[model samples]
Target: MLAAGSGAVPPVVWVPVVAWCVAWQASLQHEVIHGHPTPSVSFNRWIAGPPLALWLSYDRYRATHLQHHVDERLTDPLDDPESFYVTERDWQAAGPVGRLVLWSLNTLVGRLVLGPPWTVVRFALSEARAVWRGDPTRRRDWIRHGVATALVAIVIDLGFGVPLWLYALAVVWPATSLMLLRSFAEHRLAADPAHRSAIVESSGPLAWLFLSNNLHALHHERPGLPWFVLPKIYRANRETVLERNGGYRLSGYAEVARRWLVTPRDHPRHPGRAS
Candidate 1:
């Protein structure tokens, strides 16, 4: 169907078929990060290294995401590099518009609407600075990422004859939507590290869609456990995990949307940031 849409055959009857392909590819990348589909790390990386998620490199994401499993300081502003909330120091460093952007990004709606532009631009500029500073490893990662991105561009241009902007709208935009839903209510910067992760219980369709990432606390506790095994482990150890997490819970994404659709879950201030 997607091949047909790419003009390989004829335009298929399905509109969302391509969107589902993009989403599945993103999920495959997530699995690869956890060292699944095979034990050979190189093979796994090769399988997941496509620029389907755009600016993020699989190697860099794997490194950072593994570090995020450091349960002692899961959402600490200084420790967790993946943290979205800005520290007080960071907020002070930014000017007025920057601060406003930061605050807006803390909410789900803002994150979805503005996140792609913010992330791509910020990362590109940061990488440029790192290269200018002669950071060897950063340069290497960026080079690899650029190569992958170029290949993606060539495929779209040659294979589909689709303009870059149209390709982004077709592929990147929907993929970002799925990614946003996965990370939407995954964490909170609580005082205790165990309590940092949020459980979106009774997730129906999205459970498989997110690769059972809704059972986030279980993943944090046992990062080595495979995605297929997460549901089993979560069910067996539900009480213990919840007890450790101080009973923090939401009924599901629907409840999450209802409660925090308009409200901000956390402020621009990092919970751990000190004056």
Candidate 2:
């Protein structure tokens, strides 16, 4: 797959393939974070800590994601570290331009188009601010991230001769965008925690790509279940799963795109709390 004309990997082929690898790596990271295929946490972290996307550190992502697994805090803008929802105060503080961008990002297509850069910038800024404020944890994470990212740079740029700029723009950007596709509507604002996450009743390649995370409600309910067995478990108990989640399900990603490609799925502001 790496071969191309003139003995160099062409950008067209190289970019998409790397993006797929990176997105799949992110899925593997989620699997590793959930304690899959292994009993040792350090081993899992080591196996997935290559900075494939070059923007997020594995340890940092794992930490925030575990925090997100506090099921009762699901979709709470302040409580859930992974929530896309903005508090009313933040939404109002973001003037017209920021609000417009946030609104566009609510659409499935717009999320894939704009979410990657927006998230990376926001996360980077937050981490920078945290470090500036003398947050020791953030400082350590950034330091470790720098070392890991530098190692990845050496492998991709020096070892394989891929330019860092091309890697970032072509691989990291598109990979992050693909991740946004899975996460676009994985959760929505709801009063009940059980009702926040959705079930994507899909059995296609995207489901495999996400490692069965498309059955998001099931994964949330049983975090220790391995990816390979999720479809089996869900098939055996579909009704119970659906009933538990209040029937929040999508037929597939295509259905999601068709329904919310143009319209914003929900306002970015959390509905339960006033500004």
Candidate 3:
């Protein structure tokens, strides 16, 4: 940011750089939720505090993500907060426009271009509803995240001498898009829990940016392991992990894009969850 402000690096260049930083920050926040690099819960929490998240609060994400780890409920449309699929009731409630939007979101191109804004709006509304329902925890989290986002905005405008709109367009949106890439088809609804999560063997810069979450199945299988060690462990247990997950793997994000860019991978409605 300083480089960009000082005109040392062009804004065009810094845009992607800042975006990558924010996206990597999210992966670090993921580590925080899982108790990584330290044993002290307080330390872990504060260490990765303030996700600079334009959408969800850290506490809110933490609570829901922990619940999402329950293997039995991996793709439970109603139960999993991160689930891409929706229940039949949810589909019916969406009407037509909402249904079409859901359909678009399931495609790779749509997810890259449209997912961030949709997630922001949807999650904000959900959080606001929770606050209206007298959830004090949600209230506090919202307030804190609101303050944090404001501080970041200030830094961008005042300290860095960059326009707020530029910051959002350059930094925030791209970061969210990058995250969407990793999560695009990250999981599938399967009878076996192990088969639900996917392995994206993309060892490119994104692998590091995502903190090795490309090895997602291993992360799920050993939630306690730190990101740095995932590759080593996965390599050692490759056959076993592959067998366990029933070969739920992909080559990389490139493959994901090739396969699902225009076509939807699956319907928005969850299979076997219609009732």
List where candidate 2 sits over 4 angstroms from the true fold. Answer: 1-7
Better of 1 and 2 by TM-score: 2
TM-score of each: 0.88, 0.95, 0.94
List the candidate numbers ranked by TM-score, top first.
2, 3, 1
lDDT of 2 by residue, 1-275 (tens): 23532347678867787799899999999999999858998888778758889888887798889999998988887778788888888998999999999999999878988999998988788778878999998889889999989998888887777778877888888899989999988998778889988999879888888999999999999999989999999999999999999899999999999999989999888976565
Cα displacement (angstroms), candidate 3, residue 193, comes to 1.8
- The TM-score obtained by model 1 is 0.88
lDDT string, candidate 3, 1-275, tens digits? 88788889997788888899889988998998888879898898887855564665788889889989998998887778788788888899999999998999999999988998987887778778889999999889888888887887788789988888877777888899998899887899788898999999889899999999889888899999999999999889988998998899998888998999989999899976875
Candidate-wise lDDT, in order:
0.73, 0.87, 0.86
Sorting all predicted structures by lDDT, with the top scorer first, yields 2, 3, 1
Worst 10 residues of 3 by lDDT: 49-58
Error in Å for residue 196 of model 1? 0.3
Q: lDDT winner among the candidates?
A: 2
Judging by lDDT, tell me the better candidate of 1 and 2.
Answer: 2
lDDT score for residue 101 of model 2: 93
TM-score head-to-head 1 vs 3, winner: 3
